[model samples]
Target: MKKTLMRPVGLPESASHPVATPLMPSVVYASDTPDALDAQYEGRVAGYTYAREGHPNADVLARRIDALEGAEGGIVTGSGMAAVTAALMGLLRAGDHVLGGDQLYGRSLRLMRDDLPRLGIATSLADPTDVDAVAAALRPETRMVLIEVVSNPTLRIADLDGIAALCAERGILLAVDNTFTTPAAIRPMERGADIVIQSVTKLLAGHSDVTLGWVAARSPEDRKRMYDFAVTTGMTASPFDCWLAERGLMTFGLRFAQAQATAERLAARLADMPGVRRVLYPTREDHPDRARAQAVLRGQGGNMLSFEIEGGRAAANAFAAGAAGVAFAPTLGDVGTTLSHPASSSHRGLTSEARAAIGVTEGFFRVSVGLEDADALAATFEAGLAAARGA
Candidate 1:
């Protein structure tokens, strides 16, 4: 597995071949005959015609991810949001209903709540942690159930296996956003998810320098439909981003392991801090979904966690102002430890009441632990907490 993910495919193994796969930025391919070009377009031959429609670099990246996720096929997208939009729009019709986790990424919720309704698609938000709640929210018109394996900001772990079983029984499509726990931690397809969504801009890209997304479908029919939608809608990723993401995937397991270790240490220390009103991490014994996380994520709580300060937004802002080393970044899964205020950032689109319903408090601060020394990060956090208390 390591060898395949780290090494580039579709290239020769000879010494003449470059150690790294060279980028093919060709927008169009040449053909000896019109019939050859027609064959390529008709899927009779393997080649590239246009960069937007399809490219060698993107194809290689998608195949690698498909193998990693144990999916029948996969495709790359311009960005994470594009992947999400394509998955929903391609799969559902006007009258179809969707049951989505209430604690999803704020922008995703906005898309479903605001845009989906305009298209005549109905959406229902429910607590994914409660299997019964999710089951109850399902209707005869429901077409899909979307949930994140580990929710953003709050780090809530849903029962992927249980949900999969329910969806299988109900004949509903199960789509999992595996961004938080990449294939390195969990393969949603193996857990019976019909579709697996990945924000390659996150851990899969590792450096935060690349913007890309991928969708893996368990069925070939779904893959073809999604690919057709992507081609028609022009939701394509640049070859450079695809190449960079492939490079990042080489060291993904290593990076994820280190970051996860630091996160575990920080979660433990944060729980004991008097300035913290609550710490929400899946691996924590007090976590609402600890058992589920253990079963699905194999005891890895992931590298992201959230904690609420004793004071509300005031303390969170003060900590952000006082923190050292950690920057206030809007995105996570970078190599450096970073902080995010969900109440004002990722979950800002949701109303205050809506945010509260999912445990996103005013004082809540989510941190993406990086590959830094755990002790140093703890010291920096301690100083920031002191400043928050003082403020």
Candidate 2:
């Protein structure tokens, strides 16, 4: 189901008319894109059938993102789930198998663990940090390798080149959720990633305002398969969401660099703070995948930085509660510093055993750096650290 464009409910800023209502599922021709419609009529049908199958704003935005990713084309979906579900549903079927990384987003994990098995498809999870473990998990019936470019909460950046190479050798499809390491930081396709799935709600939009998702295919076959699945599944982002995403993108390169710079600064300092026992930043020398991250990325490490506090989960919670200026928000990639307790929020769906296997301890706190002044954000952390120690 496509999400309604969540504009303020009371009237456009220009009018005395009542607010923009949640559009009916009824196709009200997107009011914003007149020029694209006009262009389509000129001499170029572009072989597009309808707005759901193709639209100007969505197509243009997808192409722009595709350029950044160096892919053939992109399929924009209503949510990240749509992108994932469509990718699998289009390519896999009953009796097929998947070799997936263990530290996936809770929703994706649930799809594989609870749903796929019900449909007679089998899946195996393994440690993506170890390239050999990934290869070992594959079976003859395995058709897909699903993994995040960088694992959530734990911030486990995968060895994309190795995984890609393994998949290529075996004629398997490698689908990477490029949400954390957006195209600005790393173009996974260049590192051998076959299908790059993205949650544009994050770094691409660069703000918390819009909800959108997409998948870019590195080859024409992948694009055709993805589009066929997406249109039939009836999952697509609205033109309004596409518009906001496109607007947000105008400043993406600039915002991504600023946020990441501050995040790296904070991650380094968090190491010295009393309650902070471990700081996980891709750029940090101690990070296990430092070499791989450097090899695949075009820019600095991203805005997200995870740390484990000295007192463990309790201390982490205390610090978050004590912080000022930054909000204790559940989401990332916002313009304000947002903190999340992964054990409770992003990784909540996993079984206790599964969570333990991935090292998602209660002490973990993932901080998403924003556009705030780095000094002020650092002091906010200092206060939070002091409060945790004093507690």
Candidate 3:
């Protein structure tokens, strides 16, 4: 009963067809009849006229991810940022206002900070963890509220239910970036989110190989709106990328479980270590939002943890370099354990004041626990911490 929703649809019965969906790479379809092409343009029939508009493989992936996210329908995009831009651009006009959380991915924050204003859409950032602050930031022209389920780097858990209810009361659209806590951990749509955005490049794909994004709309109108905007804007995902993401989705359940378990163990171990200053993980007992995370994530702390090294940047660099098998990568959610520095990596574009406001200090380093053995990672951390102290 629990796994049915995530189960991939079986291949159709055929004697010659392969068991998996084939990649449709054709850029343009050949149609002799004008009526047929007209029907495709009119949305009366299901077909692909151009790769930039639609493809069979992308359609399958969208439906598969829609099933996972409990959405009415969805569309795939070229990248995560494309999905975000398309969703916001499709929904908002020149006069609309967007209320965004300060705890967001660096690029997403920058888009709202610098880009949205140039497009004539106004935006303001606030602490989404504070429901009152979000409510206070709302304006008469405010049309949307954007937030992350679990914030990047800091791992702060947003009050999704509370904020969703607030948006509903104010008749505002709630768009949730579910990249961190994917459908495996929390489905934002089920919690009253109007729209859900994900970077399939991260956990859903479960590998660093493919780059793709998706948007799932809870309502049919919203779904059609996003689909139409995607086609017109030409941000459609490549057929091959879509296929790879679906193949990767097959192991998402198992991969996410194992990774989350390892993360919980690593978070617990790091909290008591001598060279560690603090660990920010949702399910940890001492986390400020531990209770909220438990309620929202249904007791899952997710597959990531960020900790502060005692000696700041130098110690962080030394620990990462000294750790065996752990690479100092700029991204997260890799199948192998990897580390990233928020201040110098993801949040490097933000001002020092902006970075400090979000608690991303020079010492902060985030660890994305993979399928690595817990005991082995523990030993690596022990050695790395020693080096960090020495540094």
Candidate 4:
């Protein structure tokens, strides 16, 4: 049997008179040799071994995400929930305490609310808009404070640096999900975030075709523990998805820029239209976090913009159904503009009271700005609103 990797070129080579393996110069892609392993990585030898622990594709995606987020290193997971959950599981213990943002993705809210408690991990919710609320929720046992860079559905920006400073001073870790902002608009680590997580499912992949997630950190040491735990847990992402993620990142800067430009235009138009009761976008003048959004955001506020229709759920649904040029869909960050009702889609996992607490109402509609022609998308919404008003 050939060894996966043999050190010193002949360490105990009991391959006495065995078939000579062709000598190849040291190169990374040693996978051609069936026995080769990723030994060079762990100071063993130079070869490729397991795909789950390390694959060329996974490494490529990790490098791209790190480059995009400007992190020291990164780890990719099967889904967004896995990325966040892995970070927590790797960093926290049974007695650890967590402070969650008030405007959280509902599925994440459930994880904090139910799953963590059963593990003896305690969690408390805080208003991300209020620095005081975040600071007050911290406990001596607090291990990490997690928030979304831009709150979903509502599009509210969090005061990241302020909260990051508090975490740094208190010796706690701060993790931000940059899925909505997509690094091109806001690199949380640049503002003192300890970790930046991404759901490559949305914009990074640029298409709704792939589902993947990642956890990025500023230092290899910060990533070491998580990577170590990930291998044994058996929750690894597939190579195909990793390849799609890497390919998706190459065009991210361009896609993000284009989507954002159209989003700002849409937000401005929606804010002034009749039968539109509210436009919840970070850069809007009336947004509570407008000042912070301007301060930390690197580009036009990201591609998502949510608005409340005048009539209610029926009007919102009617408007969505009437949209022609733009696809009426539940997902975001695609090449074509897509629309959905957050109250029934993304935030549906939350109860009525919980949903209301986060400003998700029956009349709310969220559009993920895509690379579509802005005028065409605008006309589609215009026609929908006209139909809605008449109804």
Candidate 5:
């Protein structure tokens, strides 16, 4: 009994496997011989010897994401930012130039404009929706052009095919951040992106419970380089988080579809509502990049939308207070609907002038539509709008 207690009984192998992938949290695996251990380390065998190097949970999650993104290979990381860092660091060297979209997520923009320069990497920003503008911004040292499928806060859809063609001709890599669109809307890789990044913490996880991210590469060599960097830097994700993300992915398609449908309904409703100066949704007729959005998103407007309230900061505050059922969180992509103030949250790092230049005004609010009744959400927004007008 003591021996059994010390060494837990293992599950006997059976013909039938678990319906759910079993969580293997063991950080280290024992090998029968030194040669076997060496084989595992050298990638000669299909087994894991260390969690930091490669583990079952991370591998499983990576493979699942690769399939979703149509990637040749992928690597999961501790957080969305970690994945971004790994991708950039692995592919770039000192003196390399990166051209990023002007409308990228605030943190992403800061990473490129602020942090990367510290490493001797040069960076520039351009309008991703305008392929020619992006081309004009490119430098001779430019190695990567990073853009998002749907620009944050304003919903500017990128011209992926045009940019990809330009990049191919110039022999530059195109990295697309697909966290907003996910695989439900469109896979950027299919449109000629060399790399695709996802913050699995968002729609892919379908829950706000875990913080995870993944980088999918169109080539195995690129995948290996990023994977090596992630492992060496200890940016690997938790086994438990990967397992949870996998479970979330099971219903991702349904969740995303419902959320997107609801967003479409809300976008139209908000456009007609009082105290709303403007509504920015990919499918909206007035969206500046509507044509590009149609081509990239394939008819789905996606689950995210942004709007500017009539009264700016004070009105926005009042609206937040009045919107009783709806939550006001700084983050996006959850099972329940939530709102975020970009000027105060995501883009706070940027100067006021800079924020306004990108159209993130004082009254701007980004909404992450979730699996909720459309009418109920509309009612909540109505309340918020009334409050905004009063303020």
Candidate 6:
């Protein structure tokens, strides 16, 4: 009876395999003997002893992302920021310098400007849309250039081919954050980026339920270094989250296509709306980076767009209140349509001058379009614009 209670009856292996990836949530794995465990830890065999070191779910997700990005190797991390940190810390050393885009996400800007410096890594910001500006910012100590494929909120497109060529000429590594433009839109590796980072929490996960990220490297050595760093610092993702992300990935293509179509229709309608001061979307004729967007995203404006209201913060507030059909959330890449105020949320840490420099003004509202009917979404925006005019 004690033996039966201690070790429950084990089920025999099934003749057929599960259609879905099996979720293995065990933190500790067991082996038949200490010698076998030692062999597993020493990398003599293929197995997992600890979740932090490595896990099946993470491996599966990493491999899947690697294939998607055309990467030689990859690793999954606890969060998007963790993937960013791991990539930077793993490749760079003390006295190394990293040049990033000036229009990066606020938290990423803070991480480069504040955190990396504490570790003896110097950092600088440049306009990624212009390869000449990036070249001008490079220093003798510069080891890497990091840029988002598409800038957050503003929707400015990066010239990946130009920047990658510049980096290759200077012998500098180029790391691209592809969170906004998933592989569905563009693959940075194909354009000569050495490393591709994705916030799997966003479009890749699709449903907003998983907080995960991945780093895909062009070379096995780079991936090994990042994987070691992630393992050493306990930056690995939860098995359940990886599993959930994998599930979300299955429908990413359909979700992204629908959302992008809705965004295109809404961008056009908003541009003609009364209270709209400006509309920022890649496919729009008046977009600042229309040429670059054409070269990079291949005419896909993606599911995100931003517009400015005439009345600043007050109007933005009224618009949010009136847009009852879509929830006002601070984050992006959800299945349901949502609105975000960058001034109060993602870019709140930056000063007014800094925010204005990146075009994230008080009147700006970034929209994450979803699977809702296009006409219905346009009507919601009409209501929001009317509310903004009243303000």
TM-score of candidate 1 versus the correct structure, residues matched by position: 0.94
Cα RMSD for candidates in order: 6.4, 7.3, 7.3, 6.9, 1.8, 1.6
Off by over 4 Å in 6: 1-9
Estimate the overall C-alpha local distance difference test score of candidate 3: 0.88
Task: Compare candidates 3 and 4 on TM-score and give the better one.
Answer: 3
lDDT by residue (tens digit), candidate 6, 60-175: 99888888888866889999999999899999999999999988877788899899999999999999888889999999999999999899889888888999999999999999
Report residue 363 deviation for candidate 2 (angstroms): 1.6
Q: Check candidate 4 and list the clashing pairs.
A: 37-47, 37-48, 38-47, 38-48, 38-49, 40-45
Per-residue lDDT of model 1, residues 103-183, tens digit only: 787778988989999999999988888899999999999999999988887888887888999999999999999998888
Query: What is the Å distance of residue 156 in model 2 from its true position?
Result: 2.1
Model 5 scores what on Cα lDDT?
Answer: 0.90
Which run of 10 residues does model 3 get worst, by summed lDDT? 1-10
lDDT of 4: 0.81
lDDT of 2 by residue, 1-391 (tens): 9888765355347545624323333343432366666665463545343667766667767887888788877888887788888788777899999888888877888889889999988988987878899988899999999999778888877778888899999999999988888888877788788888888888888788888888876678877888888988788778778878888888888888899999988888788877677899888998877887777664368999888776766677778878876888778888788988887888877667767776777777888899998878888988988888876
Clashing pairs in 3: none
lDDT of 3 by residue, 1-391 (tens): 5655444455588878678888877787766599998988887987777888888888899889988998867889999988998789888889999999987888898899899999999999888899999999999999999999888889998989999999999999999999989898999988999999999898888789888999987778887888888889889798889989999999999999999999999888888888788899988888999999999999998899999887777887788888868878987777898889888889999788878887888888898889999889988988999998889
Give TM-scores for every candidate, taking all chains together and pairing residue i with residue i. 0.94, 0.86, 0.94, 0.87, 0.97, 0.96
lDDT of 5 at 125: 93
Where model 4 places Cα greater than 4 Å from the true spot, the runs are 1-41
Better of 2 and 3 by TM-score: 3
Cand. 2 TM to true fold: 0.86
* Displacement of the residue 140 alpha carbon in candidate 3, Å: 0.1
